[model samples]
Target: MSSPKVQLRLNGIRKSFPGKEAATQVLDGLTFDIHERDFVSIIGPSGCGKTTVFNIIAGLVDPDDGVMLYRGQEVESLRGRVGYMMQKDLLFPWRTVLDNVLLGLETKGIDPKRALDTAREYLSTFGLSGFENSYPKMLSGGMRQRVALIRTLVLDPDILLLDEPFSALDYQTRLYLEGILMEAVETFHKTVILVTHDIDEAVALSKRVVVLSQRPARVKAVHDIALNEHSPIAARSDPRFSGYFHTLCAELDIQTRKSA
Candidate 1:
C-alpha cells in the first residue's frame, strides 16, 4: 500500500582528503537510491570517485558527512550483508578453486559439507566445475575471475558491489562473462551496483547507469537500460543504444570542461 522501500540510500555523502594547499573533496554531497534487485552501474571519468562511492556503500570507507541506509534503516553492521568483487581476482594461490569459493562461508562458520554442496551446484554454471581442485595460479584470467565471482556469490549477501570486476579480461572474454554473470544474477535475484568505465558494458549489464562528474563527484545523469529487448551483441549496434552512450559521454565532457 505504501511506497516500496529503498534497498540502499546515500544522503549528502562526502569524502575529503588533505591537500598541500586545501582539503580536496573526492565526493561532494552525492545522494542516490538503489532499489532491491536493481542492477545499477556507476560510470564516470578516471578519478571521479566511482570506487569511493562503492567503498562507502560497502562500509569500507566512512563518509565525512551524511549517512548511508540499508533497507530504510541506517547500516550500522555490514559483516555479512554485502559482497564485494574487485578488479583483481584476489584468489589465494594455495587454495583450490572450490575452496576459494567456499572461503566466505568458512568465515561465517558454515559447515564445510553444506558449503561444498552449494558451491558445487553453481560451479558448472560459472564454467569452473572441472577445475575445482586447481589452484588459482593454474587458471587463466577469466577462470580466476569466475572463482572470485563465485566466492562473492557464495556469501549470499543481500547486495553485491562490483568494482570493475571484468575490466582486467580481454574484450571477448569480458563480453562472454557478462552474460554468464547476468544469468547468475538473475538466478539469484541479487541487488547489484557496479562501477565501470565502459559505457557499452554498463548498457549491457545494468538496469540503470549513474554518471558522475570528476573529483568532488556528483550525479550528472541516470540512464535506464533495457537490453532484454535486444541481444547484448545486437543491442550495442542499435542506433538508440549509441545515442544514449553519446548523450552520457557528452554530459561527462561538459562536466569536465566546467571543472577545467
Candidate 2:
C-alpha cells in the first residue's frame, strides 16, 4: 500500500439555477485539480461563479455535470472531510471562543474534555491562547476571524475552503490576517483554496492562481505566482510582486470585458 494521499479533483463540473425564464448557467465545464498540499487561489469578477465553484467542492450544492474526486476517489459526501471558512465569522454569540472552536469535534462525537484540550492547543498555536473564554462579541474583527479559523482548524480537515475570508475586515486587519493565514497553512501543510475578487490577495498568497470568466464561468487562465518570499506578509514588498499583480489584473480586465 502507498502512503495516504489527499487531493481534490474536478472534471467538467457545472451548475445551473432557475433564472427569470430559463436555467441560468453558473459554472460551465469548470475543471481543475488542487494538489495535496498546494495553496491555491481562485479569482474572478463578480457573478463569475467563483463561490459556486467552492460550493460544489464543499458539497453544499450538487454539480449538474462532471465529477469531483477526493484523493482519486469520488467524494460522496462532505460532512467531515472539508473545513469551510466563510466570509462572515458566523460564531454563535452565546458560546465562548473555545466552545465555538470545539463545535466540530463535538459534532463528530469527540469527547468534550478531549476536544476542549485540542481546541486549546490550536488556539495557542494560532496566537489565540488567552481568549478562550471570551465571547465572540468581545473580540476585535481580526480576533474574531482568528477564532473562526481556529474553529475550522481544530476539526483537522485536510483541505480548507476560504471564501473571501478577509473581505469584511479593514485594510490593516486584512493584512495582519493574511500573515496569520500564511503561517497557519505553512505550519500545518494544509491544502487551501481561497476565493476572492482581490487580485493582489490572490497573487500574495497562492502558489497558483486560477482565474475564471464571467457568468457561466470557465477557467480563463492559470498562473503560477513566483515570489522570492513564500510568506504572504514578506512577499508583498518583494521587488517582483507588482509585475505578477499587473499581469493578473490585466488578464482579469480582458476576461471581464470579453464576457461582458
Candidate 3:
C-alpha cells in the first residue's frame, strides 16, 4: 500500500488586508497538504481566514507570504485547475438549467455538442434530468444548488473548493446535498477542500478536518475522521461520531475563549 499523492500544498501562507486602524492580518503561517482524491474540510471561528485560504487556493487572492505548490511544483495561480462554488448559487436567472451547467464548458470553448452531452449527463446524474428547460427561478433552493454543483463538476477541475455551499438550505436539504456532493466526489475522483463553519458537516464529509486558529489564522488541529461509513447521514450514526463532534466543539470553544 502506498500513500496518496499530494495534489496541493500550502506552505507558510500569510495574508493581511488593510483595516481602518492598521493592517488586519488573516492567514498567518498556515500550512496544509491536500492529497489526491481526498476530501478535507476546514473550520474555524467566525472571522478566521477560512475563506481567504480558499481564495488563495482558487487564485482569487494572493497570500502576502508563503508558497503554494501543485503536484510538487510551485504555482502562482490555479485559476483553471480548481472549480469554486461559493455560498450563493450565482446562477443566471435567464439561463435554463442546462445552459447554466453548460456555462463553464462553453466559456472554455468546448464543442457545443460535446458540452451539451456532458451537461446533460451530469444533470441526469444529479437528478436534474427533467428540469433541463426550467429556469433557476422555478426551482427549489436545493435543486438550484444541485445545478450549481453540477455546473462546477462539469468543468472537471482537479480540485473543488467549496465554501459553505450547503449552508443556506434547510437541514434536510443540506444533508441530501451532502450525499450528492459525496457521490460527485467519488464519481469524479476529485480532490476537495471545503471551507465550512459547520462542525458536523466537516466531520461528516471530510477524510480529515483541519481546524484553524483565530486571525491571523494558523492550523490549530487536524483530525483524521475514521468513521466506518462514508455517507454523511450514516457517518453521523457511527459510534465514534459523537466523540469527534465533541472534541471538535471543544477545540473551537477553547479558541473562542482565548479570543474573548
Candidate 4:
C-alpha cells in the first residue's frame, strides 16, 4: 500500500520564552513531517518541549524561526486548520454532555439543530448516549476524555493535536481509551499528532513514533512501528514490542542525563 501524503511539515522550528536572566529555549530546530491519516506520537522527558511544539502547530504560539506548512502551503497561523486538546479534559463544568460536545460547533456558527443531531450520533458512537444531559463532574476520567475527543472531532479539523490526553487515567482505563481513540481517529480519517510520555502507548497507537532530545527538544529518533496485530493491547504480545520499549527508554535516559 502507498503511504499517505505529507499533510504537515515543520522545518527548523524554534521557540524560546523570555526570562529575567536569559531566554529559555524550548524547541531548537524542531523538524518533522506528519502524513495524512497518520498517527504520530512525540515522546520525550517531562520538560522536553513536546507540548510546546504542539502549541506552535496549533497556532497557540508562533515559533521563533523556521517554516510551518500545511499541504505544502506555508501557513502564518493554523487557527482554523487544527484542533488542540491539552492533557486536561477541561470540560465546561456547567454545560450538559451534549452542550459541551456542541460548544465548538456553536462557536463556529453551526446551526444548533444540526449540531444537536450530530452530537447525538456521536454520543452513541462514543457510548455516551444515556448521559447526554450529564455534567462533567459526574463522569469518570475515561468518559470525560471520550467527551473531550468527541468535542475535538465535532469541529472536523484537518489535524488533531492531542497533548497527553490519556495521561491522567489509570492503567486499565488508559488501555481502554486507546482503543476508543484509535477507533475515533480512523472513523474520522484524522491525521493525529499525539504528544505523549508513554513508550508502550506510543508504539501501540502510532504509525510512527518520534523521540525527542532533551530541553530545546529536537527529533532524536523516529521509529516506524511494524506489527501485525491491529490493536494497542494486542501489539503488546508482539516479540518486537519489548525491543522497541527498551530502545525508547534507553534513548530517553540518555537525553535526560545529557541535559543534566
Work out the TM-score per prediction: 0.91, 0.92, 0.95, 0.94
Instruction: Give the per-residue lDDT of model 2 (tens digit) for 60-163.
Output: 88889988888888875464777899899999899999889988999999988899789989999888888889999999999999999989888888889999
- Candidate 1 clashing pairs, residues 3+ apart or interchain: none
The residue ranges of model 2 lying beyond 4 angstroms of the native Cα positions read: 1-6, 254-260
State the TM-score for model 2. Answer: 0.92
Model 3, residue pairs in steric clash: none
lDDT of 4 by residue, 69-168 (tens): 8899999767876878877998999999999999889998888899899989989988899999999999988899889999998899998999999999
Please report, as a residue range, the 10-residue window in candidate 2 with the lowest summed lDDT: 251-260
- Model 4 misses residue 181 by how many Å? 0.7
Which candidate do you rate higher for lDDT, 1 or 3? Answer: 3
lDDT of 1 by residue, 95-121 (tens): 999889888988989988998899898
Candidate 3, residues 107-178, lDDT tens digits: the string is 999999999999999888878899999999999999999999999999999999999999999999999999
- For model 1 the local lDDT of residue 100 reads 90
TM accuracy, model 3: 0.95
Residue pairs with colliding backbones in model 2 are none
Q: Give lDDT for model 3.
A: 0.91
